[model samples]
Target: MRMGLVYGCAAEDMVTGLTIQCKRWKPVYYNPTKSAFLGVSPTTLDQHLVQYKRWSEGLFQIFLSKYCPKIYGHGKISFGAQIGYCLFLLWAPVALPTLYYVVIPALSLLHGVPLFPKVFGLWFLPYAYAFFAKTAYCLIEDLSSGNTLNGWWNSQRMWVIR
Candidate 1:
C-alpha cells in the first residue's frame, strides 16, 4: 500500500507516526537505508538552532503523546529492535545520565567522599576503563570514517533541540 508522505522540520511527528503505522500494517520489507535522506538548511548558527528547536519540540511531543516506538511499535517490530529504537528516542532527553554517571561521581570525590570502598572498589577500574574505551572507540570510529563533522553537527543539532 502506498502511504501518503509528509516531512519537514516541523513534521517529524507525522513522519514518525507514518513510519510506525506503515511498519505495523505493511508486509513489504522496509529498509531504513532506503528511506529519505534530508538536507537541512540554515547558513547561520542562530537559524540552525531555530530549526533544531522546532524539530526537537516535535519529537518530544511525539514521545510524550504515546506515538513513540515503545507504545505504538507493539508487535509491528521485534522486541530488540524496538528497544534499540526506544534508546534512540531517549538519547536526547536523558542528560541526567551523563551527569549521574560521570559528573556527580567526579564531584563526589572532590568533596572527600570515598570514591570507592575496600572490596568492590576494584570494579571502578574496569568501569572507568570501559567508559573511556567506549568513548575513545566511538571518537576514533567517527574520525576514521570521516563522519566527525557530520556526527558533531547532528549532535549539536540534537543537544539544543532536546
Candidate 2:
C-alpha cells in the first residue's frame, strides 16, 4: 500500500510538472505570423501544446498521499494537496470564529479539545462549500471542457470569491 501510494504520487507530480511546462511555454509557442520569422508555424506550436496537454491531463489528478517532510511526509500527493488545500482554505473561514467564540469554553469544560458544538459549528459550512465548489469544477473538467484556461481559472477562483 505504501509503495503503491508513493509511485502514484510520483506519477501525479510528473503529470503536474508536464501541465506546468505546457502552460509556461504557451505564449512562446509558434504562431504563423511570429514563427514565419524563425521558420515554424502556429499550427505546429498548437499541435505541440495539444500533445503535451493531452498526455498530462488525460491522466491528470492530484495525489493526496504526498509525503515529503517539511516538504511533508509519506502520503498521497494529489489527495493531500487538493483536499488538504481545501482543508486549510476551509479552515481560514472558521479559525477566527472558533478561537473567539467556541474554543475557550469547550476546552475548559470538556476534554483538552474544543467541544463538539464548537468544532462542528466551524467545520460544516466552509467544508460543504469547498467540497461542492471543488467537486463541481473537477467533475466538469474531467468530462468535457475545452477551455483549459477557463477551467484553470475557475478552479483557482475557488480560493477567492471574486
Candidate 3:
C-alpha cells in the first residue's frame, strides 16, 4: 500500500465537470468514468470519483471474475498481472514514440552516427527518478511496518522444525 503513492493517479480535488470517453471494453451495466466538461458543479467531482471507482471495479471483475478467469486465467496468472500487462500495452503509443525519439537517437550517436536525439531523456529524468525513488521508499516503509501483501512476514519467522 505504501507504493500506492506512485502506483495510483492523483485524486480528484474539485467538483470540476470532466469530459471523458466511454471505456472501450466496459459492459453497459458497468458504465463508469465517462464524463464531460461542464461548469463547476458540486456533483461533478463526486460523480467523477464514483465513475472512476465503477470503472476500476468493472475492470477488476472483468479480469478477475470467477466465470471469466478461466479465459483470462486465475491462480496461474492473477488479476494484477493481467492488468499490469494491459497497462503496459496501453502505454505503448507514448512509450514507443519516446523510445524511438530518445533511445534510438542516443544509440545512433554512440555508434558514431550523425543522427543524435536532442536529449529529451534528460527532460524525463526527474519523473523517472521520482517514480523509482518513491517506489523504493514505499517498499522500505512496507518492510519496516511488516504490512506486506501476505500480512506481517517477519512476525512469523521460519524456525528449524525438528
Candidate 4:
C-alpha cells in the first residue's frame, strides 16, 4: 500500500505498473459510464514522433535492463504477461527489420536484383494475403475505435515513420 513509482525511467508509469504486477498485484481496468480521465495529446506530427521515440527508447531500455519482464518476472508473473511485455518492449528493435523491409527492396530494384518471387508466383500468395489481412484488420480496428478514414490513413503513415 506504500508503493511508489520507481524513479530513473523515461516511462515511469509503465515501469511502476510492471513492478507492481511483478509483486503479485493484479491490476483492474475500470471503464465507467463516463470518462474518468482526460489528457492532452500531441497536436502535431513532430510532437507525436518525439513522444513515440521516447516511449520506444524507454521500453527498449527496459528490455535491456534488469527490469526486463522475462528476466525479473520469471517466476513472479505469468508467461502471457511476460510475452505481452516483450512484445511492447521489442518495438524499438522491430524497427530495424521494418527499415530493412522498406529499404532493401527498393535498393534491390535499383540494382536489378530479384529479391522476391514474381507477383503471380504461388509463393507470393502468402505475402499478399498477410499484407492485405493486416491492413484490413488495422482498418477495422481503427474504424471500430471511432477514427475517421483520414485518421486511419494518417496512422498508417505514422506507423512507417515511427
Leading candidate by lDDT: 4
Largest TM-score belongs to which candidate?
A: 4
Residue-level lDDT tens digits of model 2 in 23-105: 33222333354334465532454575555444333333332233222133224334444444434323334446656655577
Model 2 ranges off by over 4 Å: 1-123, 145-162
Tens digits of per-residue lDDT for model 4 on 87-159? 9899888888898988999999999999988899999999899999999999999998777999999989888
Candidate models: Cα lDDT each: 0.63, 0.44, 0.42, 0.88
lDDT of 3 at 126: 70
Off by over 4 Å in 1: 1-4, 7-21, 24-56, 101-103, 106-110, 116-124, 143-162
Per the 3 Å backbone cut-off, how many clashing residue pairs does candidate 2 have?
24
- Full-model lDDT, candidate 2: 0.44
Q: Which pairs of residues have clashing backbones in candidate 3?
A: 18-36, 19-36, 19-37
lDDT of 3 by residue, 1-162 (tens): 111111122221110101011112222223246645546632454575565555444444443333233343344455774445445323324345666776887887789886623447666777677878976776677677646844333323311110
Compared with the true structure, the alpha-carbon lDDT of candidate 1 equals 0.63
What's model 1's TM-score?
A: 0.54
Query: What is the lDDT for 97 in model 3?
Result: 65
Clashes of 1: 0
Window of ten residues with lowest summed lDDT in model 3: 14-23
lDDT of 4 at 93: 89
Per-residue C-alpha lDDT of model 1 across residues 1-162, encoded as one tens digit per residue: 455454553546455554656466553555465547566667677897777667556766666666666777777767886666666555447756765768777898889886664545776787678868976776777677556667866754655443
What TM-score, over all chains together, does every model reach? 0.54, 0.21, 0.22, 0.79
